[model samples]
Target: MEPVFRPPSEANSYLLPVTTGCSHNDCTYCAMYLAKRFRVRPEKEVLEDLAMAKATLGDVRRVFLLDGDAFVLSARKLLRILAAVRETFPGLQRVGAYINAANVAAKTDDELRDIADAGLTIGYLGLESGDPETVTRIRKGASVDEMVEAVRRAQAAGIRMSVMSLLGMGGREHSLRHARATAAALNRMQPRFAAFLTVTPVEGTVLHEELDEGRFELITPEESLRELREIVLHLELAGSIFRANHASNYLPLKGRFPGDRERLLETIDAALDGRISLKPEYLRGL
Candidate 1:
């Protein structure tokens, strides 16, 4: 079996592998699913796993579908799995999965609603960078407009979104552009949760090759912090939870948007001024 990955916030959730790998695994910087071909697990197997989980860890409150974009599964199949989940763990409070714009576009409005009503409530979207040039270079597999529309449609169907952006995804050339455009996009989407992760070139990925060949220039840690500040300064979220505390971040930041925006900026400024320490290079990871 392929290894599983989940959002940091889902550390306590029971992970259920409904899919083997990412449906669209061509992102330049990602190497998470390179060893596994994308495939939806058999319904029988999925149900059996849920049953085993229930028997082993009774009354799970939260379940996160894995390995990557489990939302790529058809509504019919997902709904069946959700039904089985509810039956197996009557106390299940929420279900979440990695989602992409293309997966959202493939599902009808009604299908999204039905899925939400059945128990799948939150979605994790990797809005790596909103700069069109960066988006193209990364082969993110979805346009900015497509991403905005997809998030909006999912939100309309009652699915709360937790959107993530990469701090240095555009490398040095497009750093500021990436930050500002990403903030603009987040302002438009108004996701329930927003997170920032620094871009790390991974082995076996195009980004790593680009870095090795000098075709890509990763921002310095200070530059990445500036890029993060630019995004935070421009963000116009309404009561959204903002986080930059991922392991990959040089400086950890977390607070509510609009309310804590100013304080967050001050924290960044302090880090910039050397009043607060940044995480060492050796501690950061993807």
Candidate 2:
């Protein structure tokens, strides 16, 4: 099985690999599944893993489907996996999976509702950048409008959505535009949860190659904080929980929308003014 990649919040959940790699692995900045081919794991294998989990862990309240984009599984197959996990662990509260805009659009509203009703309660989506040019340049495979609608459709189907954006995805040249546009898009969708991660160029990624060729420029630490500040400044979220405390972030930030907006901006200001220390580059990771 491929190494499990999961949300930071799913620390206590059981990890189940329904898929071996990302369905769409063409994004320029991502190297997560470079070594693996994409394929849906066999049903028997998935169920056997569930059985083993039950035998060892007794019962789990949450399960995180892996490897990269588990929501790529067909509705029937996903529902079957959810049902099996529920049967194996009667205490299972919710199941979560990594999803993309394409997968969201592929599933019907009824199919999504059925999956959610079956216990797969959350879908983690990497929206990356909301600027059309930036999104296209990164090969994220979804336009800004498509992403917004995908999020809306998924939430309408009863799945709580966790939306993520990258702080330096557009580089210094398009930083402000990317930030403002992403905030605007997120405001329109109003996902249940929001997260921001700083872009870290990994080896073997097109992004890294671009950097090597001097075709891409990464923002400085201060600039990254400024971009983050600009993004938060433009957000008009209703009640979504926000977080920028990921390991990749130079400045850890967490709060709910509309409520902690001012405070987060101030914290960023403090970091900008040298009142707070930023995370060292050596400590950042994907």
What lDDT tens digits, residue by residue, belong to model 1 across residues 1-286?
A: 6467899889999999999988899999999999999988888888888888988998999999998899999999999889988888888899999999999999999999999999999999999988988999999999998999999999999999999999899899889899999999999999999999999998899999999999999999999989999999999998799999999999999999899988999999999999999999999888
Q: What is the TM-score of each predicted model, taking all chains together?
A: 0.98, 0.98
Model 2, TM vs. native: 0.98
lDDT of 2 at 213: 96
The residue-by-residue lDDT of candidate 2 on 1-286, one tens digit each, is 6466789999988999888989899999998899999998899999989888888999899999998889988898888888888899898899999988888888899998999899988989999988899999999988889989988988888889999999999998999999999999999989999999999899999999999998889988888998999989999999999999999999999999889999999999999999999999899878
Off by over 4 Å in 1: none
In model 2, the runs with Cα more than 4 Å from the true position are none
RMSD of each: 0.8, 0.9
Candidate 2: residue 277 lDDT (0-100): 98
